[model samples]
Target: MRLILVNDVSTVRGGATKVALQCLEASKDAGLTCAILVGDDGEGLKPQFAGIRTVALGERPLRDGPTFTDVFAKNYNRRAFEAMEGLLQESEEETVVHVHGWSQILSPSIFYALAKHEVKVIVTAHDFFLNCPNGGLINFHSGDVCHIKPLSAACLATNCDKRNYFHKLWRFRRTLTQWGVGEEFWSRVGIVLVHEEMEAYLRYGPLRHFTTLRTPTAPLTPGPVEVWRNRRIVFLGRMCWEKGVRTLADALNKTGRTATLIGRGPLLVEMQRALPHCFVPGWLSDEEVARLAGEARVFIMPSRMPEPYGLVAAEALMSGIPVIVSSSALIATEVANNGAGLVFDSGDAASLADQLAATDDDDLMRRLSEAAFSLGQRIAPSRAEWARRMVDIYMGRSSFSAL
Candidate 1:
């Protein structure tokens, strides 16, 4: 069988593209015929993995704005459609199309081509862009989580597009078009959810009819499950309001706790000034970040946004580090259910401080460290293992759902 990976970018920057790259590498190692189809719109050095098939159809229009045409046939790039059409013609019968994300880079046009070819497809929910009009399920004016039913009149009317009503109208139009395409595309494909909570959300929203399967991921590499010391906490990922990193730093400062911020973002200098005790070393290599995760006493992910897949938390767990994540986050659910770490109320600074103080007990840290290590064994999948399981799903060997 053939495995075709589809994502927005040719380079790995964020969660969706990184996972797509991982699948590409693993599928080739497992002796599966695989190719990656990307729109090289995002700025980065293109990846050139040896002995792997990598195809870039074209780039998105520089600073392209949407029009009524985008709501119609213009959403499909002619080059990408041709590329996918050729790929489908060659291996249409046995090809499994695994689509990661499609927004600014790749649009919904390719889905139409896949539908025409009747190729089996699997869509991984990296974000809610497919259904939610606002990109994330967040209210723009209020900066709060939005639970409105997707595509409803109320949802369409809500100006939650992060800019203004004009932007909201644009997203609303795009989402309307997406709903049309997704109805046809998802009906002919199965869904892959990184977390069960995402399954719950999707089942009750758009694409609810499509079959879904759970695919939990582990860290890329296993770190030594070292003993826990009373070292400072570590915060990885973007340092922004949406990530709640600033809130976390505020809590840490208020509670007199110190931690390390490993990422760079708009609030970096402000955060450095506010949390005088916190250390900001900017972006580090993944190896260095993993090493720090292993050495740190605890990891904190106070995301105010609803993170469907918590890769940062999984990586820390692999290193035997417990997480103190937002209660509303999917990772927090994993920690609370499995004893991997503690949960603070989402976006609540005082509650975060309370949880941060609770981790001061050495005995509790040791217990959490051991439990996180055990959880890592369950969540972390080796590359080969992930490839084999994905092949099973591709070949109709397994199926799962909350239903």
Candidate 2:
């Protein structure tokens, strides 16, 4: 089978890109012809997929309009859909299009083309962009989950996160238009893959017509490194409001436990001011982050949102480190089920502090650490297995399965 993966960026900047690259590697292992189509090119990402064929859509100008209330919202690069249209025309009959992220890159035009060609298309819900305009279903200003349905007047009336009520209204209008166009084209999607069961619930509850698949992830290894001193607790992901960085910092301050923050985001300044016990190393190389994980005592994921798969949590578990996650995080379910970690009340600093204190018990930590390592083996599907499953679905050998 010939497979083509589409995403917004070529770099492994986020979980979606990481999973997409992993899938590409898995497909190659399965002896399928694979290629990647991306909207942006960056030096940090170029070497990650050295031998892979990648096509970058030419840069285009930003849309001319009134800027959103939040300046960050204006940092969007409009994508040229025509490039993707041309690419699909040259694809073979056996081609399977796997779309990861597309809100900022491939527009609705690509879906339209795929529908017209009757191409087998699979879209992974890496985030909530399809259903929510903000992509995170988070109010930018207040750092809260959005409960309103997509394209609803409530979503339009209240600026969920972008801080500008007018922009929220504009986004709602755009979402409505895109949904109409998407439904017309994507109603025939071969499958919709999600990383977690919680996402499946949300998708089925909102968009029930599509088939869903749940495939959790494991850690990436660069061999093993010598363990270091210091009872380090690491937080490794985007440093954003939705991630509950402030909450994590608050917990550390309240508990008097030192931590290392290992990612960059919009709230670094605030985090630094709030938590003196925390060390912000900014963004580090994957190698550095993995090395730190091996040395750390525990990985803390304080996300207030429903994290789909929690790749960081899996990685920490695979490295034999216990994880402490917010109860609301979807990965917390996996951690609790697998005995890999402990869960605290979501967004509660006191609860997180209490959980931290409990980790000091060596016996409990040892038990959880062993469970974490074992669970890693079960969750991390081999690349070959992932590829086989993809092929089976593409070849119509497996019946439609819902997550």
Candidate 3:
């Protein structure tokens, strides 16, 4: 089988890029002819694989925020469109095109090309961009998660775009285009969700017609869970609105629990001011993050939004540190099911404080720690096993066998 992976970045950058590379590497290991196409913005669009082929489309638009370029090319990256048309039609084999992300750099035009080529396609819903115009299913103006039907009259009226309404209008037009893309693509191929809770029917009731598979992203196993000292709570990722930073600060303050905010973002200064004793240690390398997480008594992922896949929670489990994730995060289901940790309401400070208070329960912490370590092995498998499962899906042999 020929596996063609596509994404916005070529190198390992964010979660989507890492996921694309992992699947590409795994597909190649399964003896499939694997190739990847990326929007090479001078980072060389090169991955670290030996025999796999890498195709680099030209650089993406230089503009970042509001611009005429964003309106025109953010949803219709022309260079990527031309490149995909050439690549898809070049192969006549039973090629399966697995698209990881496109809204950021590659745009939705490649879906049109896929429609033109009639290739077998599978879109992994890394985020809500495929369905929600604002990409986060969030109202940027209000900082609230959106529950209105996508593209419905309510969705059209709400200014959910991150920037101004003009920008919202731009995204509105782009998302309309993507909706067209989704309308066509969903009829032809499969949709791979990272978690079972991410079922599309929950969001779009009619989307139940699609053949969807739930395959959580492979997790990373840290060194064996060891006894450590830092009893303070830890928040490891960026300090942003969607991460429930303000709500976390309130919880920490209410519970009077010492904690460390490990990354930087817009709320850092404000959070530091509110919690004078909370450690704000900017950012750290992966090794440092692992060490800190390993030592912490509990790791927290208090996301306000409906997080599609919560990798940090899984990483925390791998470190043998029990997780306290917002109930809205998809991984919370996994952790709660395995008795690995606690789940609080998404944006409720008091709910989070209750969980924070439970962290001090020595017997509860001990039980969670032991359960968390076992759950880690189930969540993060060896790379080879990941490859085999992926191949099984591509070959139509299974639908994400349960853990």
Note the clash tally of each candidate: 1, 3, 0
TM-score of every model?
A: 0.87, 0.85, 0.87
Stretches of model 1 off by over 4 angstroms after superposition: 41-51, 58-78, 90-93, 182-184, 204-228, 400-403
Output the lDDT of residue 344, model 3: 92
The candidate scoring highest on lDDT is: 3
Error of 3 at 235 (Å): 1.3
- C-alpha lDDT (0 to 100) for residue 221 of candidate 2: 50
Residue pairs with backbone overlap in model 1: 218-380
Give per-residue CA lDDT, model 2, range 233-265, as digits (tens): 889888887888988888898878888998877
Taking all chains together, the TM-score of candidate 2 against the true structure is 0.85
C-alpha root-mean-square deviation, each candidate? 3.4, 4.1, 3.4
lDDT of 2 at 16: 76
Model 2 clash pairs? 139-160, 139-161, 140-161
Q: Estimate, for each residue in 295-342, the C-alpha lDDT of model 3 and write its tens digit.
A: 688888998778877777777776677889988787888889899999
Candidate 2: misplaced stretches above 4 Å? 42-54, 60-79, 141-143, 182-184, 199-201, 204-230
- Give lDDT: candidate 1, residue 386: 67
